[model samples]
Target: MNVHLGKTPVGLDGIAAAETVLSHVDGQQGELIIAGARVADLAAASGFEGVTARLWSAATTRSISEAEVRASLGLARQRAFARLPELLAATSGLTIVDGFRAGIAALRPEAGLDDEAAIVGACPVIAGALVQRARGSEPVAPDPDTSHAADTLRMVRGDTPDRGEVAALDTYLVTVSDHGMNASTFAARVVASTQADLFAAITAGYCALTGPLHGGAPEPVLEMLNAIGTRDNIRPWVDAALARGERLMGFGHRIYRVRDPRADVLKSAIERLAGGGADLPFASEVEAYIRTALRQKNPDRVLDTNVEFFTAILLDALRIPRQAFTPIFAVARAAGWTAHAREQQRTGRLIRPSSAYIGPRP
Candidate 1:
């Protein structure tokens, strides 16, 4: 079947590859809607479990209550924890996120295992374990009674997190739970279109996320902030980077022509984090400087703040290390990945696109 290819958009930009009921990204307006709810409304009203339930219900045509979702995910965490020895062995000598990918890949592909719950549940456990292992501590088991965000914090940090900390993390998770057909989500859907199982689909999502063009920007955003070190250094640092033709890590996004709504949501969460600390104020100042400088420099380009800017701030404030940012993103985004996988599976069509043969004719 030789499908005629028109002028292919670079990087599949402005291309509608597949239909999704999961989420919508309106780039021109900088809006993100998940299921039937706006991102800001959903992030404010729900935690990771509620959002996950909503997404799952939308994807699978199953009506799952938030309570049921939370309970299932809690049990799933325990189930995932049972495979710790194998997970650790598989992840040996890899970077933290790579460890997470390896650990996820190691999950037993059993028909009886609830794939959605297992993938979502296993991600946090693997992520927390990697953090604990890096800190020279044994991995903590998930407390099945705790919320997913709270348990993740408790497991990773080895202590009870206060209400504010949990709330902040919950907001971060909900905010990033899903965005439109992003690179990783698209990758997951592509794999799913092949009738792959949930685990394999999400594993592909993690692989796509490891690429710097996708979910890998948060750590570099942190590095940029650290290099600047103070609000005063923002202009010179950004000028030097722009002058060298280097992309500003968090100031732009391919989908968001305006300020990313997720950025605004996370920034608000940072504000609500009891006692807006020195870091919040410093970040605000740096953000202001960068926005002003970038507009002046480009004048015609819409290089506004994206999610990574405040993601770095919020995660750093939560005391999550820079290296763990992408993994943590995967932890939240796994819900979306699996939901999209299920959606694509329902379509029962392989997403096989034809590439225009621009090379010499054979």
Candidate 2:
């Protein structure tokens, strides 16, 4: 086969590999849209189920009601719960996120199963099971009557979540549900383009999100905050880190030259959840100091606070363990992954890209 030699940008930067209506990320404007709805608006007006239904509708090119989506996801959760014993047995001794990946792998997609619902529904259960097992406690089963965000908290804590907690979790889930063709979403589409099952494609997405450069920043953001300890240490620690040419966690983004839009939405969510708590005020102070220090250090570069900064605060306030941060991200992002996978499968063309050879000629 003759390979086409075309000019290719490094990392496929500024490349439009596939056209998608599921989500759009305008880095220049620092905006994100999911299926014609702005992220901020969607996060404010809808829950995870609503946003997920919209994404699914876009991917399948069919209209689906929120009630229908809720029912399907509830059923998926029950199906996944039925396999808990097998999942736990197979994922023994693995880390939380790895356990999630393992559980997904164990679930072979079948013709009768709603692949999208099954993958999205199973992630939270897997994440909750991993958290519980780590605490030497048995996993809690899903409550079909409860909402996804509410049930997730219930499963992990083995108790009912308050209304505020459920709202915060729902906002976080909706905000991070989709963001264009990001690294993990792209990986998912690649797998799906090959006519692979939704489980396989979503597992590929999880593999990509597990990398430190992607969904792994929120935990380290908490670590950085903990190391700072107090407001007085914020400037000194940030200045010292900048002097050493070290990148600050949660301060910068790859695409957004301006502030990340998702950051503001999550910041508001945290503010609502914290509601006069010392942690939120302190986090805000530290964020201000960090922003000032970064601007002073690199006057040209806009190193504003990204989504991970507030994510750390919000998840911490929710009492989610640091180790499970990335897993939670996967739980939220699974909706996007499955939607992109279905869209790619609809295209019916394999995602084949050419590589630029710079080595010795054969």
The C-alpha TM-scores of every prediction are 0.95, 0.96
Give the CA lDDT, 0 to 100, for residue 20 in model 2: 90
> TM-score for model 2?
0.96
Q: lDDT at 51 for candidate 2?
A: 96
TM-score of 1: 0.95
Candidate 2: list runs displaced more than 4 Å: 1-7, 110-113, 275-278
What's the lDDT for residue 92 in model 2?
82
Local accuracy by lDDT, each model? 0.87, 0.88
lDDT of 1 by residue, 74-191 (tens): 8888887888888779787888978988888887653445789888988889898999999999989999999999998888778888898899999999999999899999999999
lDDT of 2: 0.88
